[model samples]
Structure formats: C-alpha cells, structure tokens
Target: MKITFLTVGKTEDAYLKEGIEKYVKRLKHYTKLELVELNELKNTKALTPEQQKAKEAEMILKKITPLDHVVLMDEKGTEYSSTRFAAYINKREISSSATLIFIIGGPYGFDSSVYQRANDKISLSRMTFSHQMVRLFFVEQLYRAYTIMKGEPYHHE
Candidate 1:
C-alpha cells in the first residue's frame, strides 16, 4: 500500500527539513511514501482559531478521496510503542488496498469535519511539539517502524 504524509503547513526550519528528508529517503526502500504539504492559510489575523481550522479543513478534504484510509496525528488519540506501531502498519498493508493518509493539522488543530472523516487517530507523545518538529519526529518514527519490521538494528528495546 502507498502511504501519504499530509501536513497543513511547510517545514520552515533548515534543520527540521534535513531531518525529514533523511528519513524520507531511507523510507524509499520499504514502502511507497508521499509527502504532501498544503500551503498555510493567508491573512489569519482576522480569523479566529476555529475559522482557521474550518478553512484548512476545506483544503485537506479536497486532497483526500473516498478510498483513502485517513488517520489523524492527534493528541487525544491512541498511543503505541514502536513495535506496536510497526504492527499497525503491517496490519493495514495486509488488510487494505487503499492509500493510507496520515494528517497533521494546522496550529489550532483539526475541524469537526476532518475528525469525522478520519478512520483512526494516533498520538506521538503526551508532550506537545511545534508543528514543524512533529514532521521530523513522525518521519523518523516511520523509518524506525520499517526497520523494526525488517529486524534491523535501527531500533532497540
């Protein structure tokens, strides 16, 4: 199955960009991974947080299809160990032919519509990180999952 990493904004930090790229390149050997970064909403000074999320939701929904399995990277979602995450991916790949889309919403988080559309939700940690930093962390975890699946040394207990 193809995996799509979809985020609401760009990774502006130079260091974060490099880190995300490194894992993305490494991921090429294991699965078909696509990174899609939607442009951040413009002129947000007048918009409330809820309004921003609604507008962002419009853009996000347009990119997804009925056939794609959508998973939101959300704070209140299920938390898993590295091995368990690997197993989750493996299960999806075995059971579904749909494209798996993992979304990272904008600053204020996801809208109700976006949340309603999601098939599952996952949390990286209880502690919060900047949106840009989450990009790096998620990609690195993805790489680690693949390595663990292959019985490689990149991940250790």
Candidate 2:
C-alpha cells in the first residue's frame, strides 16, 4: 500500500526539511511514501478562522478521492504507542484500499467538511507543535512504525 502525507504549507526550516527527507527515504524501504505539500492560502488577514478553514477544506478535498482512506493528524485524535501505530498501519495494509492519505491542515485547523471526510484521526502527542515541525515528527514515527512492523532493530521497546 502507498502512504501519502498531505500537508498544507511548506517546511521553511532547513533542519526540519533535512530530517523529514531522511525519514521519508527510510520509509521507502517498506512501502511507497510520498509527501505532498500544498501552497498556503494568500491574503489571510481579512478572512476569519472559519472562512480560512472552509477555503483550505476545498483545496484538501480536491486532492482526495473516495478510494483513498483519509486520516487526519488531529490534536483531539487517538494517541498510540509506537507498536500500536505499527499495528494501525498493518491493519490498513490488509484492507482493500490502495492508498492511505494522511492530512495536516493549515493554522486554523480542519474545517467541518474535512473532518467529516476523514476515515480516522491520529494524535502525535498531547502537546502542540508547529505544523512544519509536525511533518518531521510524523515522518519519523512512520519510519519507526514500519521498522516495528518488519521486526527491524530500528525501533526498541
């Protein structure tokens, strides 16, 4: 199965970019992984938070199809240990879907429509991090999950 990380906005920090790249490369060994970065919305000074989310939702929805299993990286979502996350991935792999799409929405968070469209939601931690930094953290966890699934030594208890 192919796992895709779809996020709104770019990773500007060079350090984060390098780290994300490293994990993405490592993930390639287990499955097809792709990171899709959408351009940030322009002229947001006038738009309200809900308006921003609605606009961002449109862009996010356009990228997803009914065939793709969509998972949102949400703050209120379920938190799992590293091994449990591997099991989550393994469960999806056994399903019929060809692609598993994970999304990280913009600063205002996801709209109602985006939340409605999601099949599941996952939380990285109780603490919040910048959206750019989440990219690095998520990818590294993804790499760890894959390694755990394969009984590789990259992950430890």
Candidate 3:
C-alpha cells in the first residue's frame, strides 16, 4: 500500500526538514511514501480562526481521492503504543490497496468537512506539538512502525 503524509504549510526549519527527509528515504525501502506539503494561505489578517480552518479544509479535501483511506492526526483520536501502531499499519497494508493518507491539519485543527471525510483518526500524543514538529515526529514514528513490522532491531520494547 502507498502511504501519503499530507500536511499544511511548508516545514521551514532546516533541522526538521533534514529529519523528515531522513525517514522518508528509509521508508522508500519498505513502501511507496509520498510527502505532500500544501501551500499555506496568504494574507489571513482578516479571517477568524474558524474561517482559516474552513479555507484549509477546502485545500485538504481537494487533494483526497474517493478511494483513499484518510486518517487525521488529531489530539482527540485514539492513542496507541509503538507496537500497536505497527500492528495498525500492518493491518492496513494487508487489508487495503488504496493509498493511505495521513493528514495534519492547520493550527486551529480540522474543520467539520475535513473531519467528516476521515476514515480514521490517530493521536501522536495527548500533549500538543507544533505543526512543523509533528511532521518530523510522525515520519520518524512511521519509520519505526515499519521496522517493528519487519522485526528489525530499530525498535525495542
């Protein structure tokens, strides 16, 4: 199965970009992975938080196809251990041929429309992290999950 890591805005920090790129390269050995960075909205001085989210939702929804399995990286979503997350990825790999899209919404979180389109929701942690930081963390965790799936030495209990 192909995996898509979709996020809003560019990751500006050099360190974060380097970290994300490292895992993305490693992930290529296991599965096809796509890293899509949507353009952030311009000139948002007038828009309220809700409005900004609504605009972001529109951009996000456009990237998804009907057959894609969309999962939102949300704070309120199910929390899983690394092993469990590995199992989850393995399950999806075994069960589906569709592209698995994992989305990290904009600052105010996902709008109702985006939420409605999601097939699942996963929480990286209860504590919040910066959106840019979440990109690197998610990719690293994904690499870890694959290693766990392969019974590699990269992950430990």
Predicted candidate 3 versus true structure: per-residue lDDT over 13-60, tens digit per residue: 999999999999999999999999999999898999999999999999
* TM-score on alpha carbons, each prediction: 0.98, 0.98, 0.98
Model 2 lDDT tens row, 1-157: 9888999999999999999999888888899998899999999999999999999999999999989999999999999999999999999999858799999999989999999999999999999999999999999999999999889999878
- Among all windows of 10 consecutive residues in model 3, the one with the lowest summed lDDT is 91-100
RMSD (CA, Å), each prediction? 0.6, 0.6, 0.7
lDDT of 3 at 17: 96
Model 2: runs farther than 4 Å from truth?
none
lDDT of 1 by residue, 5-92 (tens): 9999999999999999999999999999999999999999999999999999999999999999999999999999999999999999
- Count clashing residue pairs per candidate: 0, 0, 0
Which is better, 1 or 3, measured by lDDT? 1
Q: Tally clashing residue pairs in candidate 1.
A: 0
Scored against the true structure, residue 65 in model 2 reaches a CA lDDT of 92
Backbone clashes, candidate 2: 0
**Which 10-residue window in model 2 sums to the lowest lDDT?**
21-30
